[model samples]
Target chain A: MESSRYANPYQTGFLLGLLLVATIYVTGRGLGASGVFKSVVTTTVEAVAPEHAANQPFYQAVVSKHPGASPLKAWLVFEAIGLVIGAFISGLVSHRLTFKTECPPHVPTKVRWIAALFGGACFGIGAMLARGCTSGAALSGMAVLSVGGITTMIAIFGSAYLVAYPFRRLWIGGKQS
Target chain B: MMGPFVPDIITDQLNLIVGFLTGLGFGFLLEQAGFSSSRKLTGLFYGTDFTVLRVFFTAGITAVFGVIILTSLGLLDRNVIYVNPTFLYPAIVGGAIMGVGFVVGGFCPGTAFCGSAIGKIDAMFFVLGGLLGVFLFAEVFPSISDFYRSGAYGDLTLDQWLHINPGLIALGFTVIAVAAFIITARIEKSVNPDAPVYSFPTKSHAAFAVAAIALGVVVSVIPDRQTRLLERATSVAYQQQHPVERIDPQDLALRILDRDNDIQLIDVRPDAKPGDRLPDALTIAVEDMFGKGWEHELAATKKKIFYADDTKPAIEAATLARILGYRNIAVLDGGLSKFKAEVLEVPAPDHPLSFEEQMVYDFRLASAEKIKKLIAEGGKKVVKKRKIKKVQGGCGL
Candidate 1:
């Protein structure tokens, strides 16, 4: 079955840019995605292994900075929640809501899942290393032209490009997803 | 009064409310922009779709221009805003990892959430993986917290680092984003020739580019915030100057009674109803302090003292005298009421006083004689701290 076409990239991008301006204008901070993940991880760790979370300097920092609030009480967490709701609503309205693995036809579903898991693990470590994920560091950083952000963006894209050739079969196989 | 109503003026429950609302907008926009699709997002890297690049660059450019405009308008203070501090090692290494995640998972943290929301199981895995990643990082943080905290530059903005005008950088960005858009559109066409060609209006592009640059130019041209505020407010403050500096009544009486020819009392209220004032005190209007007519008279006076009623008179008087280069100026410790309580209203010393108390009384009595003499010899005086001679007679012995 043929899937519906997406919006014009440039037009959507322009609108997104305006939204970003509003984000920073009101919040004095740029949009972030991975930070929420970090918070969630910290929360989970705290709940599952309180001693470990308390002992770790990394968890300690996030925990101590906020004295009387859950790690999930973070802005990024709320934003992510809103994001999911928004995407869900949009997907439902656009008929894009489906439970399926989107990958090259020739690339086995298991292989795709494996690749996804590996990628997610790599991203998780890297995002923490950079103190933000793509949304936080790369996009938000570039909003203010931060060196860290620009550098991270280059690293992510550059590394991805460096590895893309090796993983070409996963994407441009006999049939594209 | 203006927005950015979050951390600046509204910092309590309102912050979260605004944040949540902003999130709603962000989520809605991201979904509408089709960012919920990992294939669409990863298409940029694979050369099938350039949506990610277009959206990111557009957002970045728009945000930069918006910030410049807001800061220039004085609605936003660039100083108070939070710009992410650069941590060099973490950013690069972490970004590379996240990039790998993007390719394999086909989602970043934000897009993964969106995708999961849209019932994409792959997106859900990506989110779970992100959690794993963050957890791993935290577990290892004690080992590498130093690395995490490395490259410690505090909230460094690009404008300050590059030493270029923000306006110029903004203009430069507009040129680059437009150029990149055109080039990328071409690349997309060449890579997928069978793909539909969607062109934006050239005039709109030109108008947008022009508008962005125009905003930059306008902000760069305006003077800074402080000079603007001070220039607008100082004259008004001067016009509303009606205040006094109070002197301690006892201190004033002591100084006056000491014939501290060093001190000159001046009654410089806006409207001096001069019936009962300090002995030998001169009466003058507030305007006379700055008047060229009283410049010589003020200059000749050594200690220009006033038992002030409000601070405005002292501030105005001091400002004027400073301009005229008179250094020795003061207001009494307390005003006339304190003076009366300490001196004129004192009951006669009926009880046998201690030796120290008697000496204090003698010193005050002597000062009174000196001040009475000075007041009699015209109101000219020098202001100086009093020196009471040490008592020779024993206390404990």
Candidate 2:
């Protein structure tokens, strides 16, 4: 299959920026991702253990905040669904769709999977604590010049660079390879 | 019409559709920018690739300038726009954790979804792990609730916190972003000499950077609509050139006594003591005249009588209302102080009065007593202030 090249970063970034401005102008909000995962978790908990969900303060808070609808029926959930669809379409167009585990040459697939899982778990908890993920808190927050958003953006990038050395083996192969 | 039409023009169902469309665009952009690849994403940290920085900073700068321009043009209400609230400690700690997650997981939440969509097996695991993380957080939320809620500064903007103009901040960010782009390009070249450089500065790229900085400068120099209009309204030349029609205190008292509905009394005073205001008058400060609440009152056909302790504020507000395209706005002559002396405290005639003067004196004396009684009676009626509607936004849980 002939794979098409990715669009230029600056061009795509400008388009993304315009989209964000339009979203803010029209809906008065920015894009998000992890919130959908939260919704999914909350809904699953509610469905699987109704009594437990009802009894817990966290669950109760979530339920009370979004009264009258199933937790699955949220704006971020719909957006996430759309995001998946869009990505799928992009992948199809680029001939990049393949079921594969991507990792450095030296890293074992099992190790990559474990690291991915651990990272994802950290992101989920971190997003919950920060009130948003990269797209929500950092990118969207920066557009509006929110202090929290910029701070998070700095911390994310800064901390990543700090930890990059220890985690170098996970991404880069040895010089011999 | 001004934007942020949710709950006003756009309904909840339509808003969901908007969210979907925006997300679609967002996902498509991420994929097109090669953000769907974890290797490319992690390259930012390793300095092998700067695609993430290029796109992230460009998009952020674009949106920032876009917002500034829209607000300056009065096309978007900045007040109603959602600014993510700051929780200082939590943001720092959470962001640091997410950073570690970025290195370990290779994809943030948005990119994970994109990768998962394109049939990436590791991204699928990441999603599952994310759900597990959220579940764990929920289970342990009872103990960490206080920490989660701590250090909250509600919807604070960088400009407000820094005590600077928003345009200046936007300009500073633009400069910083451009510098980062240049420096990171050099870093990427040094880190991976054999790798293809996508962000090598071209003629168009340089031109675009210059244009963006120029735009930043323009926005910084040009004041927002409110400030411009307020300045114009307060200027002596503007006030002299565009004089507001003045209504006498006695005439206003007569209108009130007659219970005339054609006249609308507007108190433009920023500070008014309780029970000191005129009957049936709406208190809209000079600054608040541009708000959505006074749209109907200002635009209505009724004669708007603006009053303050002195005439300047009343005249300024009336002038502002006129400039904003409202009609039939008039300032009270000598303001409420004149009204008090002329209508509420009429002195008796000492000498033999002419027929016309006698009639005027009799009317003033009788009207003074009636108006005083009316003020005392009307003081009991509480005027309801209009509530400005805030647009609801945030990452929904």
User: What TM-score would chain A of each candidate receive against the reference chain A?
Assistant: 0.94, 0.96
Give the count of colliding residue pairs in each prediction: 29, 0
Structural similarity to truth (TM-score) of each candidate: 0.69, 0.92
Writing each residue's lDDT as its tens digit, candidate 1 over B180-274 gives 76776777788775543453455676677677667666656665444443343235465346222345666666666556787767776655443
lDDT of 2 at A97: 95
Top candidate by TM-score: 2
Q: What TM-score quantifies how close candidate 1 is to the native fold?
A: 0.69
What's the lDDT for candidate 2? 0.86
Q: Which digits, one per residue and each the tens of the lDDT, describe model 1 over residues A30-94?
A: 77777776677778889989998878887887776457998677767667777777777777777
Model 2 DockQ class: medium
lDDT of 2 by residue, B105-208 (tens): 99999999999999888898889888988889899988988988889998899988998778888899989988988888888888887543654446788899
Pairs clashing within candidate 2: none
> In model 1, which runs have C-alpha deviations exceeding 4 angstroms?
A1-4, A175-177, B7-11, B194-203, B213-397
